[model samples]
Target chain A: MDEHAHPSVMTFVAVWITLLFFTGLTVFAATLELGPFNAIVALGIATIKALLVVLFFMELHYSTALTKVIAIAAIFFFMLLAGLTLSDYLTRGWSTYPSTH
Target chain B: MPDSETVSNNLKHHFANLEQQTATSKFGMWLFLATEVMFFGGMFVSYLVYRLSYYNAWVAGSQTMEITLGATNTAVLICSSLTMVMAVHFAKLGKRKLTAIFLIATLVLGMTFLGIKGVEYYKHWVHHEVPGPNFHFEHEGNFDPRHVSIFFTLYFAMTGMHALHMVIGVGLLSWLLILNALERFSAEYNSPVEIVGLYWHFVDVIWIYLFPLLYLISHRHTG
Candidate 1:
């Protein structure tokens, strides 16, 4: 792998513009009434912004497969943390446990 | 010269080649960032649980935040990330002066973010928004002050942790600036710059999520 072939400045500038656009979009989107959909939309836009930064600015797009897998693994575990915990918290009231008293 | 022996002097004796060294450094950085994800993830979970349990109170607490400052800080961080990526790009091109200039630009933007954050914190303090005895949540509806204080607790915990990382990032950038001044990096051995860029971008990414989760969650209610 020739490590010297970095992303051109144009590519970085383009990514920067896209990131700023998404930032504005997320903030603006929050100002609209969307009920439960508001959070979903905000987080969705944020995820896209995060992916752009990860792929372009971090050079993961040009990295090796192992590095890519390592990155995915990190996200996988983070999801596990959030998902598993939220599942419990969201469902804790479904059935009542017998009181110790 | 043998290919192995021809590798740059910056290649460590233990590594087979420059590529290996660079990959190892990147792998280590990603792994460290993974740990940081968990570190912040805990707080996020805490916030989610409390938010679900006390929805209106969370909204009330979020409304107290200054949207202008939060939005401005987000833009500042996004621009700083651009400078950081530019620094890494120049380092790869062996342009020492450009890299140093971008690094300095990133440092300035990072400090600007902290300055704005300090002002926000000061405003909260003046308004008695801190989560303890002096804390108060002003709302015209049925909301428990204690639960609203919980929102502030999460706010301080999450943003305070994020700010701490920014402070550490500024310190690391300062060290990189000194090293760059001494000509310690070149095209073949700018892994430190690239690695630091990963750390800096990861910090920015954390805020990318934090901005929406903390400030924009219930913005329309107050708007």
Candidate 2:
């Protein structure tokens, strides 16, 4: 518990405000018909908001390099899960296979 | 006991020092959170596949959601995360009373979020939005009824799982509050508070993604 490492009250408040601002931005962006960009923009804002919470509120910013690596690894693996699975789903029709049914 | 003297008393026999013990506990929490990320990741990926396949139904189903309530719940969760971190800060500073106060504030905010979610659930129930035979969407003509029901299924499953996490978090905080009252934690040993803070913040992070992914899809055209 390093006293110097603790975040200031102002920092927490600022992060809170920023998270709220991003939440509003996501909702607003969703309302706009940006075609494919709508999901991208909404998720992009959400990722930023999640990053702020992770770094500040979760104190990952003050944590060690090992801790940072572990955190990033979690996200990386999750993306792998999403990406690999989506690839299979998206390309399922590219090759024909006999239906079990 | 004096604060300096208490530091040694707090050190576990298996750990070399307080720093190692704290780091180990934090690492354990991170590992648990990593598993949690995969747990929710599975659901989110399923959602993505279905959403892409049933784009119009997903959009129509998302439009039926009450954005105001969802946004308000997001704000509440964000504020709760703030209070939770402040509680950890105060606990580390050995300000027992402030730590307890902030923890209670977080608990109340968590309950408030759940209460709003309950209200939303009730509204859905009355509107026949729950996925089953009674399910009804005002925009049913625009998309397949089954796909729209699939959207609601994902909605309930995702948000319900999230709410369950919040409930568990509230329980954890309540126990922590009790421990704080018992003078169990001090500046020398606040790992429990810090670890729980990690968990609470992780839940908030999930909602940060869930808010947009579930509630904000195609809201402008539908609402």
Candidate 3:
């Protein structure tokens, strides 16, 4: 908090523009016939938007190292949670439940 | 009391300096937000699981989502995040009036988002999309209505929880507005504003993911 780089007004506005552009890009991407890639693209653009907000709008870029670690740890654990659950589900051969029942 | 003089400077007796105080407060807020990340992460994981299980219903359910409304709300929330950061900026710069103004703007934009969400909810209710005894999803032969009900259930659960966060954020902003009006924050002591900005921006971040996962699943043109 001491002598941290306070982002100028222009930076905030620039990030806003970038976020809006990405939002439009996601909507545009959804209209394309990309199959599974569409979901990837949507989530990819969303991750970019979330990163921008977290780093800039939330000022994590200017935060202390400890704070940055905490933030990153949160994402890491969330990934672990989702990854483990999905792995279990995706790798299962026996379908305990019917899809159309 | 000797502490009275220090208290007048807005520095708590336990903290060594204002810098330590600010950093500690921000650290605590970040910790709280970390837990919030986990809270919402569970919901997101559940969403992914169900989406994988019922891919068609998820996509079809998502298609029924009013992209126009969802996208509009995304933009509104983004604007609100901008205003929230601006509020933090003004608070740090000790510009009380600008801080209050930006906080109000954030509040207004947040409410606008919720209003759009309300309209979308009303539309769902009329269309019988609510997940209850009357829940009816108009789907083709490929997808199951029961799974579509699950989609709507997750949709409402995710976005409803999000809207609830927005409601709490609006209430926090109102409180900050009152404090701002009282001239409680200045350049040296604006932790409340900054911390609340973090919360508001986190809420915005949640919606950023929600928009795509729940609304933009599949919007390709069908002949």
- What TM-score should be assigned to candidate 2? 0.93
lDDT of 2 by residue, B1-223 (tens): 4556556767889999888998999999999999999999999998998887787888788877889999999999999999998999999888999999999999999999999999999999999999998997775455677888998999999999999999999999999999888787888888999999999999999998898898888775543
Task: Give lDDT: candidate 3, residue B99.
Answer: 95
Query: TM-score of each candidate?
Result: 0.93, 0.93, 0.94
- Deviation in Å, model 2, residue A33 alpha carbon: 2.2
Q: For residues A13-64, could you state the per-residue lDDT of candidate 2 as single tens digits?
A: 9999999898888888877779889889988998999999999999889888
Candidate 1 residue-wise lDDT, B1-223, digit = tens: 2323324547888998788888899989988988898899889888887877787787778888888899899999999999999999888777889999999999999999999999999999999999888987666676788888888888999999999999999999999999888777876678889999999999999999989888987885544
Q: Name the 10 consecutive residues with the lowest summed lDDT in model 3 chain B.
A: B1-10
lDDT (tens digit, per residue) of candidate 3 on B1-223: 1323323567888998877898898899999999989999999999998988888888888888888888889999999999999999989888999998899999999999999999999999999999999898766858788999999988898999999999999999999999888777877778889999999999999999999999999894643
Against the true structure, candidate 1 has what lDDT? 0.87
Candidate topping lDDT: 3
Candidate 1 ranges with C-alpha deviation above 4 Å: A1-5, A95-101, B1-9, B220-223
Best by TM-score: 3
